[model samples]
Target: MNIGLFFVPFFEVMRMLFAYTTEKQLVNARNATTGTQYYCPDCGSLLIRKAGSLLIPHFAHSAKEICHGMSEGETIEHLNLKQMFYQWGQQTDQQWQLETPLNDLAQRPDLLNRKLAVEIQCSSLKSTRLAERIKGYSQNGYQDWWLLGVKLRPNKKFTSLQKQFCSFSKDKGVHVWGIKKDEISLFYHIYQQDQHYQYSKKIWPSYSVPITTILNTNLSELPPKIILSKQSVLAEKRRLAKRLSCSEPKVMKVQTYLYLQRRHLLYLSEWIYFPSRYSFFYQEDLLIFRLLFQQEAKNADTIFKKFLYYRETMQRKWIFHRIEEREILERLYLEAIFCQRKAKIL
Candidate 1:
């Protein structure tokens, strides 16, 4: 239900620090006696205790052995975060397993407790792989929580991969969590304006805050209302007018389509230019959607059916898989109604 972030330095020479004994006893390389033997929890291979001034005390496989528990060339930041979470879990008296392998799911999450699987992603992951892992968790009745690293942090504009990491909740709307040193932050109420996104954030001490409390915290506030003033609408119109004069291909395509319907880009219904907070979820042009809806401007059912068609046809791709279609349709319908009411006053 919530995502998180963390920042730390990447170590070129890395393995895993957390390992288990033949008898399944958990061991940290830092506390292990030198020359004593430790084995990988997942693969049961002998592990070498690694320690140095620059490196965090950890464990490494004796050789390049294949094991899900050990990530090759793992970053020091990743290991530190795992230790922080593991220690926090212990302090909070929560049963947390570090680098635990889920044999049933054919995966090893950074941390696992009950039905929750936490993945601390510090490196780039392909979109297909991300989707597959998420699906694997869902199919096996486990909840997947992804915590982003510094390299994958969201910006004013989101990349496709960043959007894929987002999760949704009624309290926070679209949200993510980021961790930096001892502080953990929740970025919520994510909305879009034109090409960029806007969001609000709250931070807490990572170790001091109870994990359950942070996960369960609710703002209980409504998502920000979508308000388009005349000035704002005029601003968009002027920008579009400028682009049209320069004959930009994408802008011209929309202009030509409007021309076919005897509509001009700058002179059309003001409602068509109104931006939706959920616009980021849409891949099809919102402007074109509004234009089509206006052309059918008879009743709610007609508009709803048209919207349903778009959903089925994949004209709009919902990045957050957890969001229900009904919520999106209902909110957009209400937004259109409000725009219509405003248009009447104008």
Candidate 2:
């Protein structure tokens, strides 16, 4: 028999034993009073009872060893909170309920009483795993869930961590709460399945927090707009053309006109007109114009000339490199115009 294989099983056995014994200790501690005697489940050392607080019974390690403390009380605190919230909701006539044995594979939540399930995550799990678990709950019929994050600290720092949890909500329809120490703060606009935004700096360690409240709101009702303008588009094209060093004659064609229009280049669209030749990019561009502008253009030739002039002026100072010459010159000729039009009075 390989000794290594035996070691693996032995380690597993020890892990199970530790977990089992820890769980037992937690249960006993929860039921014990202030003066009750307790022992560390893992190291068999005497445990220090910290008395019951508003949350639950607390204990610490008397031994200095690594595996001598009971941390499963966090899980117990979560369950207790769930039970407390469920009962509170029922008593207050809130539209919420509590379900037992949350079915994650069934995509069910840890606690689903009403339209949403609540998951209380407080582990240092990966974002993918957390996302998968929440997705499972959503797929199992719970569209919304509250994610409550408990931090290692109980202050403003924990609230900051709650904001960090918002990044995990992308596409997962979950809300986040930051519970540090004893305070509870909730984020309303942060949806459970919203898209995630990342930062270049890595400021904190990764952890998972369970959602606590699932609101009754639709995500699609939010706004959709990119903060770009006609000038920005024109500037980008000129920059690209200059870099390419292409001297191709700039053409104010239909495709270029439509591209700007579709991108909501209202200012650019007003001053430029594309030739009818590039009908495809034009058609797509016209869709955006149709949505934004009620009246169609009555004078196409004059607009096209103005657009041509604008394109030429914008590209006058741009110097294209050999590789980018053709592409950049062509792009420069495709002008974005700003129109002087009156706003429609609603």
Candidate 3:
């Protein structure tokens, strides 16, 4: 009855898990002269070996030994990237550890330095899994970077699913990373005031080339975009106008929404659409609301008890993120003021 060890291993898609021993040590273990036990780097539990094909030798957990929900299937892509990262890390001046265990975090980062954890993903990762990893790393006071082994085909941009893999946090913004044919490629700053700036980098991650060199870029050309700056609003309005004016019926919804709301079409303040970031990481349509405020009121906090629910109702479509209601209400009030100004100018 070769049922192949009864229970199924739970952990799938992991980079490190192996009984790494030299030929001498293997001989000693076979001879029973040296008591040897292969172990999981993360959990420090005993691992049994099916040791054959040197090309893919691995250690599996012994019978009924709980993996504590951290069993992983190390793919070829994971192996290759781990090796490359190993090579890169060996060259750096900082002391580095591979498959290093963080006692408090219960995380075994693929590569760990004094300050950071470099995690590699060659498979699809869920949002919950990603968030958990980030939270774990952060709580233990380590900066976490997730690198993927997937790359877009040349001339092809990232699909939404791929972009979602790069979760958003306040300071980091929207970013994704990958290793493409031996080169470290990065896509960051994926959100912007108008269309996303979409900066990218290609690197070899050498000793002379710290990762920072690859991470930072010159984004001076993109307009300085405060969320509600009048200029940025005007720019986005121009962008939206082209779509509204287009002959295509499918793209005329913005125009219809404007007419349905019975708002002025020519002025930017009259428009209050869904915050673009929730849809496709577009900059918020916030400038008109600012411009509408009296130069003084622009900086003051005013309670817009009247338009709060209306603005909330209008913009509440397909939003899956947090809505700062107070801010939205204030902006809605300013948008009304701007509309009145446009009418007065007319």
lDDT of each: 0.72, 0.37, 0.50
**Better TM-score candidate (1, 3):** 1
lDDT of 1 by residue, 281-338 (tens): 6632567666656767745667767756755554345556555666776666676777
- What lDDT does candidate 2 reach at residue 201? 15
- Candidate 3 colliding pairs, count: 1
Each candidate structure's TM-score, on Cα atoms with residue i matched to residue i, is 0.80, 0.33, 0.56
Name model 3 segments beyond 4 Å from true.
1-35, 42-45, 48-57, 61-73, 151-161, 164-174, 189-198, 205-346
**Model 3, residue 35: displacement in angstroms?**
7.8
Number of clashing pairs per prediction, in order: 6, 36, 1
Q: How far does residue 272 in candidate 1 sit from its true spot (Å)?
A: 1.5
Please give the range of 10 consecutive residues that has the lowest summed lDDT in model 1.
2-11
The Cα RMSD of model 1 versus the native structure comes to: 6.2
**Candidate 1 overall lDDT versus native:** 0.72
Per-residue alpha-carbon lDDT of candidate 2 for residues 85-104, written as tens digits (9 for 90 to 100): 54544654555544333434
Q: Against the true structure, candidate 3 has what lDDT?
A: 0.50
lDDT of 2: 0.37
Query: Better model by TM-score, 1 or 2?
Result: 1
